[model samples]
Target: MADAVALRQALAAFLGDTQYRKFVARGMYRGRMAYWQEQEWTRFTTAHPEFAVDLNELAAALLVCHLHGDELKPDTAEVFHGCMDLARWYVEARSRLFPYAAQDVISTEGRPFEGDRIGVLFCPACRVARAGWRRR
Candidate 1:
């Protein structure tokens, strides 16, 4: 139920923490930063049950943001905005029973790449929903 602002703030805080930076560094060195273990995700979800949806959405947004690059560019910024909007819609609509509803609504896949670097891994649903935002 958390909003995009809260999700962004939480993600920033989590990523800014020294421990997390070190964790990322270690993962990078081990070539494991591109993926997460199921248990690790479970622990994160267990610790922050309230932000689960937001966290998932934020992860997807960050990946898309990385993909677009140059956040200052108008087109890239639009992509970020569109991705966030799509994520909010996905969260709101996920509980309804309907025909042609999106499947695999949360991304469980490994991190998406930006050039040679590993970006954040996002849910499959968000990725699908944001496809339109990508530049031709």
Candidate 2:
């Protein structure tokens, strides 16, 4: 998996242009990312007003790192995977209390080419492409 630094760089590249870098340098990305991410939660919260506990943020962090493999510390791959496992656990455990957007699990735009497959989540679209992984 990519290390934190690499992931950050990838994120910068993904966002494209120098604007993202400038934004991060100014700490604006952090706030924007947080706000947008909160939007994801807010949609769920409205339906489940009692929902207040969650740790998907950690999974998201690791996912971003894993997807940006070239940047994450090479050795941290396992750590990132571990975090994903826990994140899955958290999602499943809390599903009964707070409904999760199924589409969120499987990516919609497909995985990034520069992304690491080692610990990346398979989106439904990807599944359609690889449905014949072991065709007889």
- TM-score for all predictions? 0.29, 0.22
**Candidate 2, poorest ten consecutive residues by summed lDDT:** 74-83
**Candidate 2 lDDT over residue span 1-136, tens digit each:** 2243444454455455454433332332433445644554455446444433334332333332122122122221111211223377645533332221122233324434343333433233322323333241
Cα displacement (angstroms), candidate 1, residue 52, comes to 1.0
Writing each residue's lDDT as its tens digit, candidate 1 over 1-136 gives 5665554446446555553333322333232334453344455557667666643553433332222221111111111211223465555554322111223332323544234222233334434444533332
| Per-candidate count of clashing residue pairs (backbone under 3 Å) | 2, 7
- For model 1, what is the error of residue 111's alpha carbon versus the real structure, in angstroms, after optimal superposition? 23
Residue pairs with backbone atoms closer than 3 Å in model 2 (clashes) = 2-69, 2-72, 3-71, 3-72, 3-73, 6-71, 107-123
Candidate 1 Cα outliers beyond 4 Å, as residue runs: 15-33, 37-40, 54-56, 63-136
Clash pairs, model 1 backbone: 107-123, 107-124
User: In lDDT terms, how accurate is model 1?
Assistant: 0.37
Please estimate how well model 2 matches the true structure, expressed as its whole-model Cα lDDT.
Answer: 0.35
Best model per lDDT:
1
Each prediction's RMSD to truth: 16.7, 17.9
